[model samples]
Target: MTVQFYINKFQALKPDKSSGHAKPHKVCLLLAVIEQIEQGFITTNKVIYNDNLKSRFTYYFEQLQQGNDKDTPYLPFYHLQTSGFWHLDVKPEYQEEFSALKAASNSNISRYVSFAYFDEELFDYLKSPATRHALKDALIHNLDSLEVQYQRWALSIGKSEKTVKNYVGALKGSISNWLYDAGISKENVLSIGSYAQYSVVASKALQIEEFRAKNTTGNGMYSAALKSYQSFLADVTQVNVKDDIDKILNDENTTATEKSTLVNTRIGQGAFRDKLIQYWQGCALTRYNKMQFLIASHIKPWASADDKERLDPNNGLLLLANIDKAFDLGYITFTEKGKIVISPYLDDYQVLGISKNMGVNLNQQHQDYLAYHREVTFKK
Candidate 1:
């Protein structure tokens, strides 16, 4: 769709304002336009009408010339395209400028874009810290299958093969521990099959009324599955490792000595060790070459967990002294799906400084651990 058409549609969608401008309405219209474009419901060519171009331009021009809200200005067609109108390719400088505009507009626009109206509540569910973590766990627990699912999703989204491969590989390594959570069971979930089918099943499972009307046991299972998937998404977006670890450490079940021993013993053992080797074969966190200096740090507190649970590989990460200390001490942690979660408890400068020093980036391999850490360790 052409930019002018989008503007008209946006204006039409907005509630009629006789006097002052409707900031909220305008923001909602912008969000709707972007969302429609993202879902392929609208295109650049269609946005600009071939015959009514003049009329369209005239309307936007009139709005700009007579609009009450001077702060929220409308861009001309050239400005919109040059400013990287959503999907259209633009020069690097224009892209940067567009990014700035988007950033500025995001908060206002996102407020009006309700997730309740979407086909699936997946994106909305992902907004939660716990749900994101659970989703990460689900993805990691079903890593091999999830990778294929991700590829399928990527393809459906029109991502290139190389991009799909990279995303799948990165997510696999990062969220390895997601499947190991206490409540999740292998029987309830399916992996190697079609993602579209899985999504359908998942959606069906989430239909509370239908599920309840069917078998009670089946309903429970579906509820559990939905919860697990929601948690996985939460892990992806919001799980925090350090806070969870701190909670574990402070739990009445654990002692200071046990905490220390837990830290010392599992720093390089079994699954944890293997995960560390897989994630940072050469210690990406510390850049330390010596194997002795590298250690697999647990996202959850070992003292708070059973021996078997502590040994689970999904609980660990390979790190150097500073990074390990930060993770262990709750100064730093990762989101459920390997995204870095800087503690608000720390100074902004400290967080930024540490992040710069560590050079950490979210990868698929860390998703499992990141989810666990977010669920069990992150503060909030």
Candidate 2:
């Protein structure tokens, strides 16, 4: 089928607006998945409704969701099965949840569906750059005027980003901080980028009832945060990696394991391994280019990556086994600017052959995942 055929179908997702104009949450989610595929994040087409997909979808929803008309990823993903191009796989365990859904009018659909998928033909076609870009253009053009209005206004308002970011932290304060200091309350993916015109006042405060009343306009944390950084992100220029990548490739490091990973590309397999062949041919931090025994390790463990992230080449690195073990065990991290950071309390400092002066070669994507590794895995 023609790309326009798919684009038309994608832009026609149903909208249910009880209090205000409908928002295009489905279109946004689809766009997020498409973008993930183009960026080589999703290796498989199984669109599981997990935190990773939600976080990725949040990137698009922050532009469309408004006031209490929340954008729940499950709702859009679950309902997409009605569209011939999408499919929801109902597992045996979800039988009870499915029964409960049919009994209630507005029941949560995700409780009944374990995963989602796209028609193979449609998914394959969307993988093309020309096709993906065309559909993304069609979706972006579909946002309602009101949604566009918020996006525009959000861009113009200026406020303390730190204040908005610290809202949850500030609310929990010293008391709750100590009580559940390690509570596993899931972290919401927030847009901490910049925004435009904002209220610098203590005028009439907004109330829940007041804001929820039909046609009352308000911005949520997601929308506001996206607006703050939308412009900045759009204007960001990519850093060149040719020199850095070349240095690693030419380094004396040559190993059998890394070589195997490098050439293991078999009709869609080893995409990340291929990236190790391209961007980084040697250890990420350890200048040990002597690749006689290097490992192709995933920064965000392969077992944990969502659809697209697992195959992201930038997420993998070539490292000597010892350095890889140290990094894999949270003993070290890399700064966003490509500096090596060692854990504060590593045992047996004399051995391990790890040096603090190890040079690093990475691009923005590498830096991004490294930040995640540092936050959740690094010892310090």
Candidate 3:
């Protein structure tokens, strides 16, 4: 349970080598747990198999995955019990049934296990940054050696080391250009102050003419690299909001009129939409006076908001259907100055009638909600 004891355990993980390459699944899961701990998402030793942890595991899996390796986080979550430090807490009544099973499948694990946890000592050691770093480095050292071997193999096959180095730098350079184009400074999250900003920034970076012009390769290598990076980060950082309306609709005690009002507010069909219409006097972006063509969109997503934020006129925008969809999906956002900041990932903006010059009419009341949109909702 000491630091070195845990370090040795992490380094000596028994990954499947039947295919001649380590599966990387367990190591990736451990790395994801460490990341979640650092991010304050996994506060206690009990590891709930939630979307955040699953997404983080998938992120690391993508990073280290070799040929033919499939993403199956549930495998490690259950099988890690054999590794001594990890343990699974099963449902009380299902304990005997779970014990009788020889193999773990996703559905069975979900039904049987309440959560997983580490040994008390190991969990305490993981709370230390130095301990976490040492343990992670031990796990990653194997991956590093594999990369070195791959490089040597490439050289033996007549590919120069310089070509290999440039191939590696392609993704970094592409990502740098994306950050620059999105007005985010190198090494800083800028005004938004979160990784959530990367969602929209990655999107806008793809749309930048200079980015496309410089990074274009005949086979789409650079673009693919950018997308790969984007995908990994988005998976790690994106917040999954459960639909609040669904929960309310399922409550049998709730009255029909209340359900109707909530549903109407959600779809911009009720008083909330009426308020947005009156405030904007038309489309918030285009000032298009036609009322029927606009949708009332929440700046801070409905599921993540309270009742006040959900119905606040200042928290809403009356946008055209296309613009509403883009904004809802985080492909389009507005600056504090109200100018349009489109995601590079948004394809065919010209066809959709969206432009860089578009802006929304804003007041002081809207600033807080807009800030939430830029930080958490925007695709940057």
Give the winner by TM-score. Answer: 3
What digit string (tens of lDDT, one per residue) describes model 3 on residues 117-178? 99998888777865665676567544435334334333322234565455346644555646
Q: Which order, best to worst by lDDT? A: 3, 2, 1
lDDT of the structure predicted as candidate 1? 0.41
Cα lDDT of candidate 2 equals 0.53
Quote the positional error of residue 6 for candidate 1 in Å: 84
Judge candidate 2 at residue 173 and give its lDDT: 39
Q: Any idea what lDDT model 3 has?
A: 0.69
> In terms of TM-score, how similar is model 2 to the real structure?
0.42
**TM-score of every candidate relative to the true structure:** 0.27, 0.42, 0.45
Better TM-score candidate (1, 2)? 2
Q: Name the lDDT value of residue 246 in candidate 1.
A: 43
State the lDDT of candidate 1 residue by residue for 1-380, as single tens digits.
Answer: 43333333322333224554332223322333333333233433333312123222322222222235332322322223321222233344455555456433433222322211211233343333444333323323312244443343333322346644544442232121232232222333434232333444445444434445432644343343343343333222222333444454566877875664444344243345655677667655545666544556666766556755676655566675445645654656765444466555333324223563345555565566566666766645
Compose the digit string of candidate 2's lDDT tens values, residues 1-380: 77778778866765666656666677668866775565455657777676547665654564456667565777677667677789877778767667566432224454566667787767777777556655655554445542234333233222233433433332233212322333422222121111111111101112223322311342343232332333332321101112222233354664645433332321112556446756766666655565434556778754445535655777777876556656766777788776778776454433566667765777777776887898988878
The better-scoring model by lDDT among 1 and 3 is 3
